[model samples]
Target: MSRYREIKYRTVTSFQRRIGNPILKRLPNQTLLETTGRKSGLPRKTPVGGRRIGNAFWLVSEYGEKSQYVRNIQAHPQVRVRIKGRWHAGTAHPMPQDDARARLKTLPRLNSAAVRAVGTNLLTVRVDLTN
Candidate 1:
């Protein structure tokens, strides 16, 4: 990655980790993706923006594999998503081949706009809800 992109990634992710995530995840109505920590053997919930379609929930990972939640998903595909204050079990799949930019168009507008503006290595993730 270019130096600029690397710096941007660090800056954005640092803010999200330290400030944004803590506040957002606490919101009662926030959409959340829960994944088992890759090394900690604990649950990690992240505030996300996405729309549930059919038996699946779709989201774009702005940081792709570098994102902690994505790494956790790689370690454990089984996950839970809290959508509209209800939790649903699912399997997380990171689609590197999918066109994340196009997929974003189909998601929540505010989030899509933010993702487009800040994302560097965008990736699409699908959760097949089982409950």
Candidate 2:
């Protein structure tokens, strides 16, 4: 990862750790995703902002496609997501172009400053959760 990306990731991780899950619950479009570490096999969790598209929740790789979380999802799709303190187990699947495009149109717009600082893309993936 580039220096900028690394710094951004660390900042976000720190922020989430300091804030805990209540703030995540108030945010209508956020989810806390837990995935097993690829190397250590230890549980790791990260806060992600997501949107509901059709029957699945969708997450965009804001830190670019090369993010570790994205790679982990690809390696092991099985994941656990927490929304409003409710936990749901799921598998993540890459979203198709059409679905991505449609979802992008519906997503809440962010200011240019936020977009530039975060360096997120419009590419999305679906979270197939178990009820």
Candidate 3:
């Protein structure tokens, strides 16, 4: 990462963490990704944008392994996602070979746009819904 991109990433993510996320997580329509904290062993939820197709939900992480939730999934693949107000248990997998940009285009526009805007290391994550 260049100096400029690194600074930008820190600034943008800090703003989102302190402001955007808290509000977004409260919205009824927002989908929440729940991952167990790798160290604390507590559930942590983050607002996310994705689509549910059949028995799976697809999402692209803007920061790949650098993301806290992704790191959590690395330690524990089992996760829970809140979609349309219902919770579904699933296993999260990071698909390094997947085309993250192309995958984003297939997701909800608002989220895809945000992900495109702030994401540096785009990564694909697929969760197999156990329902």
Q: Please estimate how well model 1 matches the true structure, expressed as its whole-model Cα lDDT.
A: 0.96
Task: For candidate 1, write residues 1-131 as lDDT tens digits.
Answer: 99999999999999999999999999999999999999999999999999899999999999999899999999999999999899999999999999999999999999999998889999999999999
**Candidate 1: RMSD over Cα atoms?**
0.6
lDDT, candidate 3, at 24? 92
Q: In terms of TM-score, which candidate is stronger, 2 or 3? A: 3
Q: How far is candidate 3 from the true structure (C-alpha RMSD, Å)?
A: 0.7
Model 2 clashing residue pairs (backbone)? none
Error of 3 at 27 (Å): 0.8
TM-score of each: 0.98, 0.65, 0.98
Give the true-structure RMSD of model 2.
4.5
Stretches of candidate 1 off by over 4 Å are: none
Q: What is the per-residue lDDT of model 3 for residues 31-130, given as tens digits with 9 covering 90 to 100? A: 9999999999999999989999999999999999999999999999999999999999999999999999999999999889999998999999999999
Question: lDDT tens string, model 2, 22-107?
Answer: 47546655567787778888877776666555657766655544556777777788988886667888898765464444555555
Range of the 10 consecutive residues with the lowest summed lDDT in candidate 1: 111-120
* Number of the predicted model whose TM-score against the real structure is largest: 1
RMSD of each: 0.6, 4.5, 0.7
Single out the weakest 10-residue window by summed lDDT for candidate 3. 4-13
Kindly report which residue pairs in candidate 1 clash with one another.
Answer: none
Candidate 3 ranges with C-alpha deviation above 4 Å = none
